[model samples]
Target chain A: MSEYIISLAGLTKKYGALTAVDRLDLSIRKGEVFGLLGPNGAGKSTTILMMLGLTEPTSGSVQVCGIDATMHPVEVKRKAGYLPDEVGFYEHRSGLENLLYTARLNRIPVQEATERAYLLLKRVGLYEVAHKKTRTYSRGMRQRLGLADVLIKNPEVIILDEPTLGIDPRGVREFLDLIVQLSREEKITVLLSSHHLHQVQQVCDRVGIFVGGRLLAEGDIPTLSEKLFAGEPYIIEAGVQPLPDTARLQTVLQDIEGIRSIQFSEGLFRIGCQRDLTSAIAGAIVRSGLALTHLQRKTYGLDDIYNRYFEGGPVYEQTA
Target chain B: MIFITATLKEDLSMNRLLNIVALLKAPPAATGRAPHPFRAIVDKEVSDHLRSWRFNILLVLILLTCFGSLYISVTNIGKAVKPDDPDGAFFFLKLFTASDGTLPPFHVLIGFLGPLLGISLGFDAINSEQNGGTLSRIMAQPIHRDYLINGKFVASLIVISVLFFALGFLVMGLGLIIIGVPPTAGEFLRIIFFILLNILYVAFWLNLSILFSVLLRQAATSALAGIAVWLFFTIFYQIIIKLVAKALMPSEMASGQAVLHYQELILNLFRIVPSQLFSDATTTLLMPSVRSLGPLTMEQVYGAIPSPLPLGQSLLIVWPQLTGLIASTVVCFALSYFSFMKREIRPR
Candidate 1:
């Protein structure tokens, strides 16, 4: 097995009577994009801080790149880069200057730091206004600059707390695309913490949904759905053309052995089934000669999982 | 000139020279561990303080009053009461501690303004980092958490010492130009101690302000807390001490020794206020003929001596005040360090 780059064992953090992170165990493999998904105050940031050794865990350990993070936080930090939820830069400093300061902190030489700073600013599409004070830049530019700050040390693992927070939709897309590219091309393991699942869904290889300081489920999208929704119906949603009558569609779907339930409206049919029997259902619809314009599986995203898990419903545990 | 000009870009401020050397020589790549991060933090914080309006406004305030004090001292020193008076020995430094008529002396001004300077510099130091959202980002770097606090402390101390020394030397320089009297070696040593006293006294306030900054969330709240503490010590503290002393010891029916004891008790109580410590240290250091901070009994002063104490003897006498200022500073710093370490950096 490939070694896990980031590993936590029984990690717990408590404040007086309140447990912020409780009895947590997680592992993120090298070069994998792992998202820690949780709502506000659900301890996602606390977990991230513990993993980086910024916040000491009440019990247990964090191992980053084979180093004990708690015992050797600086060493782990040297190999890890963190972008906090709200990325702050010195307002009086130029974007390039801020990055250079981080570079110098990481002990990059002056000439080399300046060069790397310029290159990273350009990489983040902030080179045009690299010389302007950060206060003048938009929130998006400051975030991109924060990314540049983290990358200055060439960290082996990048920890981003709410990477898409407070960014415009366009900026979010650009930023996520950059993250995906960084993971793929640079082979850097990324641990992204966010309450929003759709944002992580676009880039994460695996995700851990946290509720009440407890990780409820951990897996890829399909794996999680299959496990959580096992014995529950798989849904197929379709839109039909030609002022479609519901009778024909229902009649066609009635013949399918796997079909559990079907509901048809003006042009839409929400079909619940034992499995993904879209091909069979679609074949029957075609045979009945109703023009099927669109056909897709009705998916259960993270919000549904979060709600179910939060409502004290069962979640699938990773068996192996 | 051209070659030097080219290198000037690299070392614009002598500030970053140590950082450059640290970065260039055996960077993390070679050693597999980066150099200490405090240098970078110190450099950044130093620049921030320099560009801040708080520092600029105070700089102007101090310069105006100090130069005014210098002008007054120069004019006053023109007429002398005696050729060999003890105060005449350190005529040059007298400009720093003696008032003409209207404004307070340089030492008194510093004794009052020093805490305000300290508070302004540091009251928002950490909380502003939190408010601006940079604390987490910097803490995430590959540096010890201790570096953050130590870096800020060292940087502010550097600035405080520089400001005090520059002003002290300027007043001395102006005294030289106007009065043409150079200070003796003992007088020069006394001046150095006076400036050192200012730094330690202001550093106490700086530490206190940082402590408040760590405890309070908003920058404005921390600033207010800092100023409030300053006000308490500068104004309310003495009044409260007097009231407490009066209640504790009734002088109307008390014996002479009891009154002396009461006076010493009140003076000891004043030691708690950092401004008082500063004032006591400055007066004793500047005016050597002044014997002590507390009331002296007739028996203790039976010798009737009016000689200037040596630098060592004077320091010995006021060592408690000096140590008291520094100890409080250390305690406040310790509090800030522990609070910052324990503080969970998550946003509210």
Candidate 2:
């Protein structure tokens, strides 16, 4: 068996003169939770649709579970489930019935479909309202139901587009947790696309950063940061009481081997370093006779990486 | 002893199946076929249309047209039949399509009701799904796009066909109770054919409305376009056809052949309208005593028989009209299928 379960090769989609998704090659391993992060119109949805065989790609191929999605969409779909952004169920149907409807479309037997639907509904915390009409459910409940709906068929691969869009912070956290559980506990491969940086950071094992139909960066968050922000230095922030000693603090750290630059303002010293030097910096501050109020090493998060690329950093412009 | 043992085994298996169904929610159906993926779509669409306010309103409208026209037909059939024969042999059938002094025949009533009912069910069929953001979600399922739209159409057709058949039988049963005379086998067969054609006539409009639903992005615009086409066919078309016929006719029609030629042209023009097709088929089927609807010279009718025509003869006479309705319905459906397949499902 191939290591990757979902693969896209030279995938491109064009709507007349506008290319929605340019030539992109991507592959996700089995049981991996992959996140696709990009701004609106970055072609994330188009790419997801292409992956599901819902939209035809102009020049590319998508294979899910070793099945060519374009040639045999039904076979690909049988093993994969997709949850579109802003999930809408049949308003008149209850949550359970709606899932059953989807189950029926997958050609599952009626009796067995009913059982799985109820079990998944309970797992998603919607069992109590399973019989209630979907229209009456809150947006969060609907989103959770959407999760359960995709899981009804017990697909090997799940793709969710903008899963936390327009959701509250708490709901977003719960959804992210559910996604982690799906990948970690159930061993289901997941492909999640979202605008929420924190959600992607929290759930995804790997992420692809897209911009203007092009994949700018694709890897783990730290790897992307290291590669794209190579020239940029890590920051260690320290707060000291008695601001009169700021000059003394800078002179003590000036001769350190890996320390690149030092800036002091308002009793706060920010030391830029080539690597993690929290211990050495703390010792130097102690030696300089300054009481450390706050000492924290700030890692480069996905937000900083996104901003650097999105703001047209050197790497972004070079690729563009 | 054998029966008891067999029953026990069956009960255990049935319980096990139910348990799995409840627990799993969607075990594949135990059948040779792939469990017809479109079945659920059809069922959901059927239930949705049945429970919707729009469908209910259209149902009420059709019922009002049926019962109102039935009331008029019963009195008219009584007077139109021979005075000595208080009840005609084809009593139930005439009770359905006969006209009174006040109202047109039951066929005309259906002509007005069927298309509107079909349009109301289908005008927003596709676009409303898109507007609600459900189109993409449904498309995400294992089923193809063909199943979704075709299932919708099939569901609506099933509902409307059932409704029309029920109404037809209700009128027939009412007529039987009132006149106390059951229609002959021929009359029964003819009414069944009329009901089938009625379904086909409405199917044309259903396809037309679904086509609009596919072509137009807004629900309201598709609905308005459907109504506009319906209005053009029903009201304005005849006027235009009449004016065109008058202009094309000779200045002075001094001979019988001239009048016949003018009348043939007008009849051909009327045949183009779907409602005319429906009514023409219904008139031949329900009023079997009438041999022809076209103008004939005196010599041509000199030896014509007065007896009611046989069912086969009536069908042969209206075969062109029936084919026209079916052909147009298929044409509309083909157009809808083509556009829906070619359409990109993106929300743009």
Candidate 3:
């Protein structure tokens, strides 16, 4: 079998003039946590839907677990569990009842389904409210229930669309940590789609930066940064006590080896360079009779990468 | 792009072959998997309906209509029957058709309430799941998408059938206890046929509401659309047809054949209404004396003996109406099925 548990090749979905997913080619490895990070309406959900065969691609192929998704959707669905952005349950039924219904749909035996439902509920930290109606539960609890619901099928892959949307910060953290724990424990491939970059950055082993129906970049965090900032890799920031003049600081930082550009704005300095020049820049600042209050090398995060590609940078055009 | 197009063509042909192969495979029962996925859905829907307040209220209303009409029929049995009249011997069938001036007959009450019950049961069948954000979840399950729709239709049909049969038998039992006489075999068969007709009539509305549910996004909007169609067919359609017929009526100088043709034309136009078709079918089944639904000339009725027709003859007379009802129901269900399968599935 191929390494990929989910493979999408030239998958495109169009609604009249709007191309929701445009010639997308993505493949996720077995037991790997892959994040599809993009802004809202960036075709992440559409891509996930096609992977599970919930929505057919206008043109192209989707193979999940080595089965053609469009031709054999039921087989694909059997091996893949999906959690929608705002997952909801039957309001009148208890949380356990809701999960039981899903288990039955998967044709699990009554006794085994009930045992698994309870076990999953406890794992997701919803055991207390297992017997309560879902309507009375909060949004965070509902999301946790959704997590357990996805797990009930024992699927090979889990596709989550905006899983952390509208949850509290603490809930989001706990949810991400739980996801990481689950994936590691079960060796299950997870394709999580979200516009929340930092949340996905926390759990995903690899991420694909998507925008406008195209994947601009795909790799682990460090590799992605290296790709976007190929020419000048290191980014250093320094804060000066009693604020130095912009021109003076610029001249001093420019003289250092490997320093490409220096910009002093908002009482600090932002320096882009080829390599780590923290020591060199600090030495230059102190020798120039200026007290360096704060100095740290900037680590490229998903947010920074997103901004560089979208806000204003040549990376967007280059990647396109 | 050319490569993509080539691959796509190959994929389409492959999918067609796979579909044929799947069709040739063993059916679900023979496959011997845990309970069929379809059964689970149907079971869930059945319980949901049984527990819902909307269905309970409609059930109560239907029970009230049954008892109210029975009271009318029982109280007026003396006037409705004459000892010397053989045609009036059908006392059990009269229980459904007999009406006091204050209240309509049992069949007319069913005609009004049946559509409401069907609309209530099915108007929100799809859109409610969609709006509640549960549709995508269920769609993700390992089953054919059509199972959801089919299960809903079947569940509602089963519920309607059971309720109608129970009410029919209940009325018969009560009439038997009060009158101290069991209905003859013909009367019993006629009652069974009438209950079957009621179920079919309601099924037509249920399919209609389900179609609306598939086409519209909001439950309230679909409900209102179903109600609007129901109102039009039950009330305004006949009025409009009558007005059109009046304007095109033959003058007094016209031939007897022309007048007869005009009346037949008006009758045909009126039969377009589902309730009119239902009432015609029920009257033939329940009364057995309704020999013909269309206009008959004086010559055609000149030498005819007045007698109640057998069940087979009555069925033959209403065969076209039954076909019309069944065809319309099938057409509605097919439309809903195709539209649902064609539409994209997405969270709201």
Residue-level lDDT of model 1, residues B253-315, one tens digit each, is 879978888788888888888888888888899888778778878888998767778889889
What lDDT would each prediction earn against the true structure? 0.82, 0.82, 0.87
Q: A87-197, model 2: which lDDT tens digit per residue? A: 888788889888988888887776666666765776688977987999999888988999988888778899998988878999889888988886776678999998778
Superposed model 2: Cα runs more than 4 Å off: A236-297, A315-320, B1-34, B83-91, B253-261
Count of backbone collisions in candidate 1? 0
Would you list the clashing residue pairs of candidate 1? Answer: none
Candidate 1's TM-score on the B chain: 0.88
After superposition, which runs of candidate 1 have C-alpha atoms over 4 Å from their true positions?
A: A238-271, A276-320, B1-28, B31-35, B83-85, B249-253
- Clashing residue pairs in all predictions, respectively, total 0, 20, 0
Candidate 2 structure quality by residue, lDDT tens digits, B43-115: 8899999899999998888888788888887778767687444234566777876676577778887888788
* Residue B47, model 2, lDDT: 90
Query: Per-residue lDDT tens digits of candidate 3, residues B1-348?
Result: 234224323533667545533432312122245688899999999999999999999999999989999999889876877776545868778888887678898998998999999899999999999999999999998999999999999999999999999999999999999888799999999899999999999999999999999999999999999999999988899889979998999999999889989999999998988899999999899877778999877888899877789999999999999999999999999999999998778976
TM-score of each: 0.88, 0.86, 0.93
DockQ (Cα-based) per candidate? 0.43, 0.42, 0.28
Supply the TM-score for candidate 1: 0.88
